[model samples]
Target: MAHLALYRAWRPQTFQDMVGQQHIVQTLQNAIRENRLSHAYLFSGPRGTGKTTAAKVLAKAVNCERGPSQEPCNECPSCVRITAGTVMDVVEIDAASNRGVEEIRDIRDKVKYAPTEVRRKVYIIDEVHMLTTEAFNALLKTLEEPPAHVMFILATTESHKLPATIISRCQRFEFRRVPLEEQTARLREIAEQEGMNAEDPALAYIARLSDGGMRDAVSLLDQIASFAGGNVTLEQAIDATGGLPSEQFARLATAVRDGDVSAVLQEIDDMMKAGKSADKCLEQLMHYFRDMLLAQLAPDASSSSGRVADPSDLRQLAAGFPREKLFGIIDTLNRYQTEMKYAAHPQTMFEIALIKLCTASGETPSVQEGSAAGASAGGAQAGVSSGEVSKLQARLADMERKLEAALKGGGVAGGSTSGASASGGGRSSGVSQAPSKAPRVRVKLDPFVAAHDSPQSKELTAKWPQVLQRVKEERVTVHAWLVDGEPAAYADGTVLVAFRNTIHRETTERPANKAMIEGVLTSVLGKPAEMVTTMQKDWQEALASGAGASREEAAAGEELRLVPEDGTEPAREPIIEEALRLFGEELVVIKDD
Candidate 1:
C-alpha cells in the first residue's frame, strides 16, 4: 500500500470517533435512530471541522447491512463497501469541478431512479456554494423533494453565497471549530497511536497553529514529525512552521516599552535575515501582546492554550504595559496589519509600525492639535506641567479674542502690525492689537458659472458621490468636512466646490486637505483637476449678479464688459496684479468693501 497522509489515514469513520462537534453528532444520531431524517441536509463551517466526514458517516449509518442503525458496523459488507467508495448507490461529488447546469440536470435526472446497490442512494456534494445560479436552480426541485430511497448532503465553507431559495429548502447544521484543548488531545492521541515521540508542548503548538482545524493540525504534526525524524519538539515545530518563539516577542516588546527604536529595528532585521516573513512575524507579535493583555486584565483566569510562555513571565510583561497603552498598541498593530495585506513591501510597513510603537506615549492621542502656544513654548515635552498647559490655553484664548476684534474692525488685508495699530481706533492701550486676517483667495467664478450647464460640469456633478466615497476611503476626517460641499461648477481644469458651513469651507481649503481631495478627483475623473472652495451663499450671490449670463449674449455682441469712470481700466494693486497673473483673470477677482 502507498503511504497515506495522516489526515486521510485518521479520517473519522464513525460519529463516535469525531471530536469537538458533539451537538451535531448527537442530533444526527437521534434523528437516524428515530427515522426523522430530512431529505436534504446542508453542513456548513470552516475547513477540517468534519463536514464531509459527518456526511460519509451518516451515509454508512443509513445503509449499513445490520440495520438502518445509529452506528455503522464496519464489519458489515454494506458499511465496508461504502467506506471503500465501492458502493454504486453512494456518490461523492466535487461541486467545485462539476458546477454546471448540465451536471446538476444530470443529477436531477438520476435522483429519480431507485437505489441499485443500497437501501438509500446518498449524494454528498462538497463545496456546494461553487455551483452557478443555473445549477442551483436545477438542483432545487430535486433537493426539496427527492425520492423516498434517496438522501442529499451539501457541504460548504461559505454558506452565505448560497441562494436563499436553495438554503430555505435544506436542513442546515453549522459545525463549530474544534476547541484548542480538544485539538491538542487529538494530536497527542494520533502521536501515541503512531508510536511517535512528541513532547506535550510540541503537540499543543501544532494544534494552535492549525487554528482549530483537526486535519490541518494532524497534517502539521505529521510534517514536523517527519522533519524531526519521529521525535518532535517545540523548537522543531517552530522551525518547520517559520514561527518565532515567545521569548523573541518578549524582547521586542521590552524594547518597544523602553522606546528603544534601534533595538526593535535590529531585532526585526535579524528575524527577516533568518527568512521569517514580516506579516507572519507581525501576526505572532499581535497574538503575544493579546495574551499579555488577557493576563493583565484577568489575573485569576487561566492562560490561553496557545500561549507557551510561563504565567509568571506573562504577568511580569503585562505589568509594564498600562491598559490604555496596550489598547493603542493593539489598535496600531491591527491598522498596520490591514494595510500590509496589499503593501508591496510589507517589511517596510512592519518596521514603521514597530518604530511608531517605540516612540508613542502611554496615552497616545489619535488626533494632534498644534496651537501657537505650543509652537512658541520651545523645549516643551511630555513633562510639561498642568499649570503650563492652562497658561498656554489662556494665551490661545486671548489671541483668538484679538483676532475676532481685528476682523470686526476691518484692520488690514495682510498680517501687518503697522496696519493693525493704525486701524485700532479708540481701543484701550492695555489690549494688544492682533494682526489683520488675510482676505480669502477665491476662484473667480464668472467663466465657471457661464459654463455651469456644460457637459464637464454635469459630469462632475454626476461623479460627486464617487469623489466623496474616495475621500472617505483616503481620510474619513477630510470626508466629514468635504461632504457638506457640492460641485458648484467646473471650468478650465478647476472644480469649484461650494460649502454651506464656514468651518467646512475653511477646513476643505487647507493645502493638505485640498491636495488630497484634488488627487481623488483626478483619479476618479481621469483628468488633472484643481479644487477651489467658496461659501455656498457667495456662490449663489455671484450667480444672481449676472455671473451666469447666457453664452448666447456674448455671441450676439451683447458681452458684459467692465469699464472705469475715465473710459480706461482702473489700475490694480501690485499684489492683485500678481495674483491675477498667477491664477488667471477668471480665477482671481478684487473685492473692496
Candidate 2:
C-alpha cells in the first residue's frame, strides 16, 4: 500500500479529536444528542481548520445504526461506510470544479429521494463560495426546504462571498485556526507515533511556519522528516523551507540600528547568494520587527513558542530601537514591500529599502537610554542644533511683528539709497539713523470696477478651474500658490485676482511663478493676458468705499499708482518697483541711516 500523507492519516475522526474549536464541537454534539439537527448547515473558517472533517463526522453520528449519538461508533456499518466514502447516500461535491447551475439542479433533484444505503442523504459541498450566482439560486430552495431524510453541509474559507439568502437558511458554525501550542503538540505526537526523531524547536518552527493550519504543519513535518531521513533538526527544517534563521534577522536588524550601510548591503548580498528571494527576505524582516514591537509593548504576555529567537534576545534588540524609529522602519518596509511586488528588479528595490532604513534620520541608536529626551536630543543632533532652531524662531517672530506694523501703517519701508549718498558721507557717517518707509503700491480700483462684471470677467470665472489645472500641469508649485486666488475682474489684457492669504499672493507674484501662470493662462484662454493680485480684504474695502476710477479714466490706462500714506506719489525707480512687486509690502523691510 502506498504511504498516506500525515495530514490525511491524522484527519480528525470525531469532534473529540478536533483541536482549538471547543465551542463548535460542543454545539454540534448537543444538537445531535438533543435531536435538534437542522436540514442545512454552513461551516466557514480558514483552511485546514476541520470544517469539512466536522461535516463528515456529523454525517456518521447521525447515520449510526445503534443510535444517533454524540459520538459515532466507527465499528457500525453506517459509520464505516461513511468513513470510507463508500456509502451511496453520502455525497461530497467540490464546488470549485462543479459550480454550474446544472450540477446544482441535479443535487436539487436528488435531495428529494430517500437514502438508498444510509439513514439520511448527506450532501457536503466544499468551497461553496465558488458557486456561481445561478448555482446558488438553484440550491436555495432545496437547501431551505429539503426532505426529512436530506441534509446539506456547505463549507467555505471565505464566508463573505456566500449570498445572505443562502446563509440565512443554514445554521452557521465558525471554525478557528488551531493555536500554536496545540498545533505543536500535535506535530510532536505525530513524530513520536511515526517513530521520527524531531526536536521540540524544529516542531515549533514548523508549526509557526504553518500559520495556524494543522494540515499545513503536519505536511511540513512529513516533508522535513523525509528530507532528513526521520531525524529532523532546526537547521534541516530551515534549509528545507528556504527560511532564514533568527540569528540572521537579528544581525540584519542590528546592522540597520547601528546605521551600518555597508554591513546591511553585505548581509543582503550574502542572503541573495544563498538563494533567498528579495521579497521573502523583506517579508521575514517585517515579521521580525513586528515581533520585536509586540515584545516591547507587552513583555510578559508575549509568547516565545514560535519566535525565531529567544524572548530575552528580542527584548534586548528591541531596547536599542525607540518606538518612533520602529514605526518609521515598519512604514518604510511596508511601502517598499508594496512597490517590490510590481518591480522588475526586486533585489535592487530591497537593497534601496535597507539603505534607506540605515540612513534615515534618528535611525541610529541613541548614545543614552531610549528615553524621550535622549531620542529628541539625538534627533536634534542629527538634523539641526536646538540653539539654532530657537534663534531662527525668534528672528521669524520679530519679522512677523515688523511686517504687521508696516501693513497697519499702510506703507512698506523702502531700502533703496541714492548712489551719491552711498559713495560719500553715507559710508563715513558714524551716527545711526532710523529706517525710511516706502510708499504702499495702492491699486486704482477704477479699471477693475469698470470690468468686474463684464463678459470677459465672467468667461474667465467659468474657465478658472481649467486655468488652475493647466497651471498645475505646467508647474505644480505655481498652482499650489495660485489656487488660493479667484478671478475678480478682467480688463486691458490683465486678469485681476483676489487673494485672502498674504503669503500666497506674495509668492505667486514672484517673477518665475508669475511668468508660469501667465503662460498657462495665455495657452488656456487663447489670448494674451497678464495677472495682477490683490488681498481680498483690501478689495472688499475698496469696493465698499467706492474708491474706483470712472470708465473714462479706466479706458485712459489708469490702473495702479504708488501713493504714500500722505496721499503723495513717490518717484520710484524701476528696480525699486520690481523689488516692491516681488517682496510685497509686509516682507520688504527698508532701513536707512
Candidate 3:
C-alpha cells in the first residue's frame, strides 16, 4: 500500500498534467478565471479518460488558498489535504457503495453547512449513475438550491443513466476516450522516463491495444516492463499479449494473397502450436481483413503513402480475392464466430476454420481462380494451347481432390498432382458445381387478389406482415414461406381443408386447423376469401418432379437485403409444406391491416 501503482502515481495533479483533453481543461480554467463555476457540475465520459481526475482537480482548484484560481498551489494546507483526500471539507464519495436514498438524504442534510476546514465544502461523487432514482430525486432538489459555500462534482462513466432532469441542473462536461496518436505519444514519454528502449512500432502496438485509453496503455507498458526485464521489445510484447507477430500474420496474409490455402492453414496451425490462441488469431485476422477490405473498397485507405496504417497485407489478400469471394469469406467467418463463440476448445474451431478457410470457396478465391486456370488447361484439346494453359487446366480438373487432400493434411497448398498441367493465367472467379436446371413453373395469382383481408385469413396474414407489404407494393422479391399447407374453413358453416402431402400433415399447416388461416384476405376482396388449400404434385416432367423443392429461397425480397433490422422479420428460409406450393401464388390476397 506504500507504493502507488503507476496509474495512481502519475495521476494528473493539475490541468497541465492531463493528456488528450486540452479543450475540457481550457474551459474549466476559464470558468474558474471568470468565477463562473456552477454550484453542481457533472463530469461524464469513458473510463481512464479523466472524468474522475478532472472532478478532483476542479475541486482542488476551487478550494485553493488563492481565491478560486485555475491553479491549486499544492503547498496550501487545503490543497495538500484535498489532494491527499484527507480534508474534512473535500468529501470523495463512491456513489457505487453508498447509493441508497438514506445516504443521499444524509448528504442533503449536510449540504446546508459551510466548509469544515477549507474555503468551500466539495462533495465529489464518483460513479454517480449508480444512485437510485429516489436518491437522484432527493439530491436533485438539494442540488438546485445548494449553499453558496458548497460545490458538487459528480462523475460518471455512463451519463446516459443519469436522470435528464438532474443533468439539466448541473453544468456538464463530456470527456472522450483519448485518440491513438495521443496515447502513443504519452506511452513513448512514459517509456522514455523509465529508461526503457521501446520501438515506435512497439509503442504504436501498445497504444492500439490500449484502445485510446492512456491509463490502459501505461498499465500494459508497465506489465511488459516487469515481465521482460524492464525493456519492452516488440517480440516480447507480442509474446506477453499473445498477439501473433505482425510479421507472421503478414506472411499468412501473403499466402492468402497468393491464393494459397495450404499455406494459410499451415500458418494457422503453426501459430496455434506456438500457444497463440486460435480465437485471438481469428479475431486479429478479422481485424486485419477489415482493414484490407476498407483499403480495397475505399480510395481514402488505399495506401500507406496516403494513410497512416496502410493495411497493405490485408489489401493484398483482398485484391487477390474476387468481390463475391471476399463477401463469402466474411460471411463464413461471421457464421463461425457465432457458432463457436461458446465452444470450450477454440483451437478446434480454428483448426477446422483453417482447413475450411483454405479451400473455402469464398475465402479461397485465389485458389478457385488458380483451380479454374488449371482445369481450363487440362480440358485443352486437339485445339488446346500451351504449357501454362495445360498446367492450369490440370489444376482445375483435380481441384476437389487437391482440396480434400489439403483439408486432411492440415491445409498444405502444394500437393504433387499426377494430373498437373503446364498452364497459368486462366483463373476464373468461382468454381462451384453447376446446378442442374430445374423447370420454372410460374404460377400466377388470380387478378382478383388484392391486399387480402378476411377474418379466417388473419392467422396466415399476420404471420408475414412485412412480406405482405412487399408483395402488394410489388417489391423486387417476395417468397411466401410454406411451413404448413392445408385447407381450413370457418364461418358459421362449411370450410374446405386440403394438405400437400403427409409431410404437410402438421396440424399447424392443416386447413382443418381453422385457427391457422384466414385474415386480411377479405379486405382485399371485399368478402371472405373462402380458404381452400390442398397438397399438389409437381406438374413438370423430363425428370419426374414433386411439389416445390424444399429450401426454396424467397424471390419476393430484393437480393442483398440487409440482415433484418432489430426486431423486424428475418429473411428466413421458406418452409417445405405441400399445401403451400399447391396454393403458392393463389393464397389469400393482402390489404391494410
Candidate 4:
C-alpha cells in the first residue's frame, strides 16, 4: 500500500508479466506446471536483467493458495504479504552484509523448521559470492540435501566467485545483458507513462552509455528527468552526462579531414569556453573520427545504429580527407584524451592534440563499421606506436653517445678518432652503429676550374683549413656557405667579398668559420675585411644540395653557375671536401694509438 519507484512498481509478479527473458520465464512456467521444480536455483547476470525478479515470481507461483499454480494470485494474503516482504515463511537476505559463518549457521538452524503457513518455505540470498569461504563450506553441507519443503534461490552479478560445491548442487541460469535497442524501447515506454518529454536521440545516447544494462538506463533516465524537469533536452542530456553534440563532433571530424589547423583551434576554443569537459570532448570527438574512419574504409557501412555521431555528416567529413587519414585523427584524439587527466591545463592539452591531428600523416586503417571501440592512446596509433618510437629514439641517442665515447677512446690502435675539424666535433671516421646509413653529400665541380678565377675567393679558401687547426685549439667551428653574392673583385682598399644568399643565411653559413677565414684573409691581404652576402642565383647546386654548399672552381668557362654569386663559371665545392670524406664527416681527432 506504499508508493514505489517505477522500477520496483514494475517488478514482474508472474510469467506473463515479465517483459524480456521469455526463455527463462517460459521454461520455469513449464517446470512449475509439471511439478518438476529444482530445490535450489542460481541466477547469474548483469544488474537490471531480471534475475531476482524471476526468483520471486517462482516462489509466489509455487506457494499460491488457490492452487500449486504457475501464476500467483496477488489478492491472497500469502501472495500479498510475500510481495510486500512481510511473509515469515518467505525470507530474503542480503548475503553481502551477512557473509560470515555465523549467518550461514543461523540459516542452517532455521532450515530444520517446516513452513508455518505456506506449501513451501523459500529463502532468497542476493550476492551469494560475498560469503566467506568458511560460510560457503557451512552452507555447502545443507545445500547438498535440504528439506523437501524448502527452496533456496541464490543470485549474483559475478557467478565465478561461487564455490564449485555450491554451484554443483544448484540449477544455474546465465543471463545476458539486454541489447541497446531493447533498453531504449523499455526507457521510451517508461518515459511515456511518466509523461516526461524525451527525444529518441537522447534516449539512445543514454542506452549506449548504460552499456547493455537496463537498470543503468533507467538510472540515467531518473537522473536526466530530475535535471531536465521531466522534459529531457538533447543539450541538457549531453551536458549532464558529458556527451558530445552531433554537430560539434561532425565539425571536429570535418576539420581533421581537411587538415585545417585554424578551424580545429577555433572549435577547441569554443568548446573550452562552453565549459564542456576537455577529456569528454576528446573522447566523443575520437568516437566521431572512428565512425568516419569506418565509413571511409568499408565501402558499404550505410546504417547508423551503432554510431554515436551522425552517419550522414560522416559522408561530408570523409570526403574532406583522403580515406587513409582517418586513423591519424583517431590517434591524435585518443592521445589527447588520455593526457587530459594529468594535464595542468586541459585546454592546452586538447589544443595540442588538435594540432597533431590536423598535421598527422600516414596510412588510414580499414576498420569495420560500428566496431571502432576502445581506441585508447596506446591502441590508437597502429602504424606508429608512440611508446615504441620513444623507446627507439632514446636507444638511438644513447648508442650515438656511446659510439662517440668509444671512438674518442681511440680505434683498435688506441688512437682517438673523435676529432680534427673544429667545424665537425666528431671524428670523420664513420660510426659503426648507426641505424641508418649516413647520406652522401656530393658537389660535382671538375678539378681544373676550382684552382683559378676568383683570386679573392682563393685567398679566402686557403684560410678555411685552419678551422680544423683551431678545433685542435678547442675553438668553436662555424661553417657558412655563401648562397648569395659572388666574392666580386677584391679591388682597391676594401678587398670586397660578395655572397648571393640572404643575410640570415650568410650570417649562419659560417659565422665562426667565416671569422676564422676573416682572420686568415686579413693576414693574407693585410686590410679591413669586407665579405657581403646576396640571394641571387642562389646557385642551382646549393639549392639542390638542400642545406649548405661550399663555393669552389670559379673558372670563366667552367660553367657551374650557382645563384647570383660574383662568377660566370660553375660553383665548385671548397678544398674541405677531400678532408671531410677521408677523415669522416662527423668528427676527427689526433690520438695516441
Candidate 5:
C-alpha cells in the first residue's frame, strides 16, 4: 500500500463525520433525504473548512446505488468509484488552472449529455472566484438552468469575489472555521485512531496552531509524530509549531511591565536566534497581554491555556498593568505588525515597537499602593488633615501659575544685571544696545513667530532629522552652514533658522546656500519653503518682546537654550505625537490585526 498523507487518509467521508459545521450538514442532509437537490450549489468559507469534503459527499449520496440517500454507503460500486475518483460521472476541476471561457463553455456543452454510468453527472469547481469574467458569463446560463441529469458544485474561500448574477442563481452554504473545542476533539480522535502517544495538551496545542483548519492541524501532527516516533509531548508540539514556551511569554510580560528594555530585546533576540518568526513572536506577545486583560476583567473566567503555565502568573502580571496601558501596548504592536507587511526589516520594526512600549508611562497598582501608604502614614504622623493637603495643593498650583506668568512675561528665570537690563521694558523696540564695534541686526520677528507656530512648522520640526539627512545628501556645504542653526519659527512655508553669531547667519543667507536648503525642504516636505536666517540674540529679543517680557529682562536672562549651538542631537520622535497619530484623541487603544 502507498503511504498517504494524514489529511488525505483521514478526510471526512460523510456528513456525519464533518465537524463544526452541523448547520450546513443538517440542511444538506435534509435536502438529500427529501430529493430536493438544487441544480447548482455554492459553498464558501475559509480554507480547510470542509467545503470540498461536503461536495464529494453530495456527489456520492446522489449517485449511491442504494438510492438518493442522506448518507453515502461506501460499500456500493457507485459510491466506491466516486470516492476513488474513478467515476466518469463526477468531474472535479481546479478553477485556478482551468478558468478561461473555453473551459466553462466545454462544461456547458457536456451538461447536455446524460450520465455515463451514474444516476446524475456532477461537476465540482474549486476556487471558483479564479474564473475570468468571460468564463463566468459562459457559466451563468448553465449554472442558472443546468440539465436535469447534471449538478454543479462551486466552492471558493472568497465568496465576495464571485459575481452577483452567478451567486444569485446558486444555493449558497457558508462553511465556518471549526471551533477550538471541536478541533481539539477531532485531533484527539485522530491521535487515538493512529495509535500515537499524545497528551491532550499536546493535541490542543496543535489545534491552536492549526488556527481552525482541521487539515492543517492533522498535517502538523503528522510531521511532529514522524519526528518524535509517535510519542508526542507538549514541548515537541510547541517546538514543531515554532512557538515559544509559556515561560518565555511570562518573562517577556514581566520585562515589559518592569520597563526593562534590554531584557525585552534580549528575549526577542533569543527567540529569533532559535528560528521563531518575528511576526509570530509579536502576535503571541499581543495575545499574552490580551489574556492579562481578560484576567483583570474576569479573573475567575480567565483560562491560561496556551498563554501561561500558571494561572496565578497571569493574574500577577495583569495586576501590574492598568487596563489603559495594556490597551496602548496592544495597539502599538498591532500598528507595527501592519507596517511589517511592507517593511524591509520587520525584526527591526518589532524591536523598536517593544522598546517604545517599555518606556510608556503607567504605574502598576503596587507602585501606587506604596506611594499612597507612605502619604497616609506621613500625613497622620504629622497630624495633618485632608483639608490642609488640599490647601497646600491649591497654594502650590497658584505658585506654578504665577511662575509661568513670569516666564511668559519675559522675565528670565535667572540672568546677569546687564541681560536683565537689556530685557527690561526700557529697551527700544527693533533696537538692542550693542558694542560700538557691533551693529544691531534688524528682523521681522512677528512674521517669523507666526510662521514658526504654524502646523506645517511643527511637522517640519518632527521630521527635521529626515530633512537634515536629505540636505546632507544633496549638498554637504549647505548642511554644514545650516548645522550651526536650529529652526526657531516656521510660518507659511518660511523657516527662521536662528544662529549664535552673525557670521554663520550671513553665510547661510547666501543665494546658493539658501536655495539648496529650500530645494531639500521641497523634496522632503512636498513644497518649497523659504529659509530665513536670524542671529540668536535678535531671535531671543523678538521672543521676549512677543512674550510681554521687558527688553532688559529678556536680554538679561541667560541665552535661551531652545536650539543647541554646539551640535546637540535631536531626541527620539516624541512619544506623545506618535500616540496622538495612532489613537487620535482616545484614551483607549484598540488593536487591529
Candidate 6:
C-alpha cells in the first residue's frame, strides 16, 4: 500500500475518539441513541477541525448493523463499507469541484431512492459553501423534504457564504478550532502509537504552529518525524515551522524596550533574510508582546506562551515595560498589521512600524521618566535594601505634608518670578521671616484672567520661544511636545496653547506637564499662571467667530514655517523629506498661532 497521511491513517473512527468539540459530539450521539437524526445537517468550521470526520461518524452510527448506536461499531459490514467509501448507500461529494446545478440535480434525483443495503442513504457534501446560486436553488426543495430513508450532511469552512434558504433547511453545527492542550495531547498519543520519539515541547510547538488545526498539526508532525528520523526536538519543530526562535524575539523585544533602533532594524533584517513573512513576523512580535503583557498582569497565565524564556528574565523584562507602553505597542502593531495587508512592500512597512515603536517608547514620558529612576533605585524595587525604600518613602511623605500645608495657606506660597521684577530684589524682600517650627501664614495669589486681544496675544506670541526654552530646561520631552503648540489666547492668568495634533495636546495636558508649563508661564509673565491646551482645530473653531482673522489666522496664512526640530510643519511628519516626498511639494502646512 502507498504511504498514507497521518490525518487519514488516524482518522477518528468513533465519536469518543474525537478531540475537543465535545458539545457537538454529545448532541449527535444523543440524536443517534434517540433515533431523532435530522434530515439535513451542516457541519461548518475551519479546515482540519474534523467536520468531514464527524459527518462520517454520524453516518456510520446511524447505519450500524447492530442498531442505531451512539458509537459507531466500525467492525460491522455497513460501518466498514462506509468507512472504506465502498458503500453505495453512503455518498461523499466534493462541492468545490462538482459545484453546479447538474451535480445538485443529480443529488436531488438520487435522494428519492431507498437504500440498497444500509439502513439509510447518507449524502455528504464537502465545501458546500462553494455551490452556486442555481445549484443551491436546485437542492433547496429536496433538502427541505428528503425521503425518510435519506440523510444529507453539508460541510463548509465558510458557512456564511451559504444562502439562508439552504442553511435554514439543515441543522447547523459549528465546530470550534481545537484548543492547544487538546491538539498537543492528541499529537502525543499519535507519536507514541507510531513509536516516534518526540519531546513534549516539540509536540506543543507543532500544535501552536498549526494554530489549533488537528490535521495540520498531525501533518506537521509527520513531516518533522520523517526529517528527524522519528525523534523530533524543539529545534527541529521550530525549523520545520519556519518560526523565529523565541530567543530572537526576546532579543528584538529587549532592543525595542531599550530604545535601540539600530538593534531593532538589524533584528528585522535578519528575520527578513531568513525567509520569514513580514506579516508573520509582526504577528510573532505581537504575540511576544502579548506574552510579556500576560507575564506582567498574571505570570502564571504566561506559561501557555510555551516560550523557553526564564521566568525571572521574563519578569525583569516585563518590569521595564509599564502596562501603558505595552498596550500602545500592541495597538500600533495591530493597526499597522492591517495596513501591511494592502502595502506593496510589506517589509518596509514592518521596518517603519518597528522604528515608530522604538521612538514612541523612547519618548513616552512614563517610560523615559521612570527609566533613570528605576535604574538608579536598583532592579525595579528589589535591589534597594528594604530600609532604603522605607527611608525614601518617608521623605516623600514629609514632602507631601509640606506641599499640602502650602496649598492650604500654612506655609510658603508657590509662584514664579520674571525679569520684570519689583525693586528690592522682588517679592521676598519685606516679608518677615517666620519662627522656627511654626506653621506660618501663606497668601494665595488671585487667579489671573487671560487676554485674547491683540497686544496680550502678541506678547505671548513673542514670549513663546522663551517659554519653550524654559520648558526644555526643565523637561526635554515636554519641551519637544510643547514646541508644536503656539499661544492661541492669553488672559489674566490662563494662556490657551493651540496644538495642531492631538498627541502633542494630550502630552502637554498631563498633570505634571501642565504644572511645568504653568510654572514656565508664571516665570515669563511675572505672576502665577495656568496654561490651557487645545487642539488647533478646536481653537480655530472657537476663534472663527470671536477673534476673526487674528494673529492665529495671520500666522497660519503666512509663508511656510517649520516646527524647527525635524523641519516638518508643527505636529506633522517627524522628518521633512518624507513629507515632501509624500506630498510632492516643498511646502508643508502648519498652524502657527
lDDT of each: 0.77, 0.77, 0.60, 0.63, 0.73, 0.73
- CA RMSD, predictions in order: 11.5, 13.3, 15.8, 21.8, 14.3, 16.0
| Model 1 lDDT tens row, 208-293 | 78777888888898888888999999999899878998889989999989888999999999999999999989988888888778
> In candidate 1, which residue ranges exceed 4 Å CA deviation?
1-4, 305-313, 362-593
Worst 10 residues of 3 by lDDT: 418-427
lDDT of 3 by residue, 1-593 (tens): 11237678678899988998999999999999998888999888887788888888888998888768887777888888888889888889999999999999999998887776888888989999999989998998888989899999999988999999999999988888787777778888877887888887777777777666777777788777776887788778777777877667667666755657778778877986788777777777666665556767773652322112346545555676566655666666766665466555677776666557665544334455567545543443333456635544443444445554566877423421110110111111112211122121122111112112335435444443542443233211111223334223222211233345545333333322322233333344344433333333321220133223321232232121112225343221121121123224222111100
Question: Local error of candidate 3 at 405, Å?
Answer: 12
Better of 2 and 3 by TM-score: 2
Instruction: Give the C-alpha lDDT of model 6.
Output: 0.73
**TM-score, predicted candidate 3 vs. hidden true structure:** 0.60
Better candidate number, 2 or 4, judged by lDDT: 2
Q: Judged by TM-score, which candidate is best?
A: 1
User: If scored against the real structure, what TM-score would every candidate get?
Assistant: 0.68, 0.64, 0.60, 0.56, 0.64, 0.62
Clashing pairs in 1: 444-587
Clashes of each: 1, 2, 57, 42, 21, 9
lDDT of 1 at 470: 84
The local lDDT score (0 to 100) that residue 374 gets in candidate 5 is: 36
Give lDDT tens digits, candidate 6, residues 1-593: 12238878998999999988899999998888787889999999988889999999999999999879999889989999899999998999999999999999988888888899899999999999898999999999999888899999999999999999998999999999898889989999999999999999798888877776788888999988987889999988778778888789889888988889999999989998889999998988887788788788887763445444323346778888889999999999998888687666789889999999988776545444444433443333444565645443433333333344565985333322321121111222111212232232211111111135557768888888899888776666788889899887655445677789879887886656877687788899776656656567766655555433344443342321112234332232222223233333312221111
